[model samples]
Target: MTYKGDVTVGGPADVHELTDLMISKVAVGPMDNNAYLLRCRATGEQLLIDAANDAATLLTLIGDDGIGAVLTTHRHGDHWQALAEVVAATGARTYAGREDAEGIPVATDAALDDGDTVRVGQVELTARHLVGHTPGSIALVYDDPHGHPHVFTGDCLFPGGVGNTFDDATAFARLIDDVETKIFGALPDETWVYPGHGKDTTLGAERPHLAEWRARGW
Candidate 1:
């Protein structure tokens, strides 16, 4: 289950065996949003992130393993297009950032704030509230003792730059600062970053260019 260095991003729908966790990702809907199924090997308990779109496809991916919970990274419509359908079908508990919880049509069983933990079997993911993308947009941190940590940055931090701030300077600043302090500064360079869309990147690859991203004002 141990992996060396960084993980290589796969195509549209694929599963990556990362340490003790198995991550299955599928790009769905019109936006090409990524829906990830994270399964803990020890207890076989699982959690689904985004549930972005394509209910039929998401159900097929869920199969019989049964998702213990579904975590919505933010309240963005594109990110939760299939949320109701998926939750209805799976009967899984719903969790989201407290501030943005009202934006979603579905009721969240639990409101996850920064420092709150979501348990998937034995794995405990720490919630990091990264503002700007959405007031309560959060990234779940899985810090493995033996390997680099894995952070699911939902539309807040991306490969080359921070998520779009919709031309708001203050929001952009907040996102970059949070990423630098909460993500980059806290985790090692080998930490794997899985964003809301597109390919993944390691901290090491994006670390040196933080200044560049800041200077360019993206």
Candidate 2:
């Protein structure tokens, strides 16, 4: 059960230490939703992002390690259905956008807007509202000890595409703008982009495609 390198689940544990961040991905269910367990090597503090669809598997991944916080990108069941169980098991505070907070079991602890920081041991994640897939979808950004900025882009921005738009077309369009002009455009080119459901890409890699995305009116 111990993952060693860059894991893609249902496969061997491809573990690797990225500076102070020990990363592992647990793909739960048929959707292949990736739930990330990020442990800060400096303090051994754990942060769980996107609980996916299987609570039992998530509990096993978390184990006895201290989970300081659990963050959900949106209200989609595949992304956060196991949140309540994780919270109960670890007592880890949950964070989500205020608009979708009601969907979560614990709503009081939910975050309301962009720029709110949630601390998990030594790691402090700044929440950025990247609404599109949902009215309250968000992304988390933080700097690793090596000073490499990492963004856990929930479902907003993927490797080469964007999240599905079922909410409001106008709002979804605006959300894409915010991601381009704010999230992706605002971060340093070297920032590592870990998305909710795809291969990892960087801010620099996604920058060039912004114009093409805009041309398609997405």
Each prediction's total of clashing residue pairs, residues at least 3 apart in sequence or on different chains, is 0, 5
Best by lDDT: 1
The residue-by-residue lDDT of candidate 1 on 118-217, one tens digit each, is 9888888899999988999989999876677999998988879999989889988998999899999899998888888877888899999999998888
How close is every model to the real structure, measured as TM-score? 0.93, 0.87
Stretches of model 1 off by over 4 angstroms after superposition: 1-12
Compared to the true structure, candidate 1 yields what TM-score?
0.93
Q: CA lDDT, every prediction?
A: 0.86, 0.76
State the weakest 10-residue window (summed lDDT) of model 2: 4-13
Clashing pairs in 1: none
